[model samples]
Target: MIDGVRAILIGDATLTGLVSTKIYPVSAPQKINPPLIVLIRKDADPNKCKTESGGVGRLDEIDFTVLIMSLSYGECETISERIRFLLDGFQGISNSKDLDIEYETEFDSYSEQAKLYVKNATYTAWYKT
Candidate 1:
């Protein structure tokens, strides 16, 4: 599920044109360039059972935190907006895996150590495994 979601986000032309292959799954590299995206799985819980069988389900409600980091605030905002536009309310098959994504705006801030602008977007992704 994580790999499928990462592939979908990384395959976006707008995002790739901006940051290329700088999309990290859990953590970014020690020395990362500006305008990168990091995907973190914040929390996950099993969805309500459909059948009477207790553990016979394949769906999960997963929350992901997408962090957009850039050198300037404007760039960060633009990238974050593009990511939201690309991912919000998206439902389809990615890499032959079934998934549904619903996103919400989280928060934005600035990092003093790296001198980077940061934007965090939270997504509720329902994945079938």
Candidate 2:
């Protein structure tokens, strides 16, 4: 599921041009990079509601935190804005699977250790299993 989401983000020309294949699923490497994108699964909850046929459905509420790290806050903000434009309210097929974005939030932060600006974008995605 996370791979599908990553594919969508990586496939976007605008986003790819900025970060290339620097998007990480869980966390970035130990070596670290100045400008990169990180995808973190914050939480997930299963939908208890059954299907119309009285069978279980593959519905889940998955929350993801997408981080855009850059040397400066302005650059981070710019990349984050492009990411938001590409992903906010997106509904489509990724890796031959259907996914829907339910909600999203974007914010800013600082990485004291790395001394980099972090733009955090959180997304709530609904996946139909």
Candidate 3:
């Protein structure tokens, strides 16, 4: 079974002592996926979604109640704030519920359930449902 989460990378001196180094889901490195958002405004069907036409893409919306499971147990509110802080670090995050965490570990608790978004070589977060 997979363990909980710990902090990933610690921030710089300016950010040190402000965030934890406890990476959740085993406190190891994690690989990130791709970033893309698709909306079904005109002709959308979940049964026939495809990647070529942007039907299938990274997750852009968060229910705010889903399993954003953290390995280390911080207060939900605190973690939420930390995650919110990461959005800008991920790049191109504008009023979006998107954020991606990147590491280099092969095994992950959220494997196949998350993707990393990048713009101009910057990190962005979007997960899969």
Which model scores highest in TM-score? 1
The model with the greater lDDT, 1 or 2, is 1
Model 1 bad stretches (over 4 Å): 51-56
Estimate the TM-score for candidate 1.
Answer: 0.90
Give the per-residue lDDT digits (tens) of candidate 1, residues 1-129: 777778887889888998898999999998878889999998988765564565666688899999999998898888888888878878899888778898866898989998888999899899876
User: Each model's number of backbone clashes?
Assistant: 0, 0, 17
Best by lDDT: 1
The TM-score measured for candidate 2 stands at 0.88
Please state the error at residue 7 of candidate 3 in Å. 8.3
Model 1, residue 118: C-alpha shift (Å): 0.4
Instruction: Please list the C-alpha lDDT of all candidates, in the order they appear.
Output: 0.85, 0.83, 0.28
List model 2 lDDT by residue over 46-122, tens digit each.
78658889987877889999988999888888788877777778898999867887447787889798898988888
Candidate numbers, best lDDT first, in rank order = 1, 2, 3
Q: What is candidate 3's lDDT per residue for 1-90, written digit by digit as tens?
A: 011011222332322333343322312244421111111111212232246676766444221111233323243334444434543334
Q: Which stretches of candidate 3 lie over 4 Å from their true place?
A: 1-16, 26-48, 53-80, 88-129
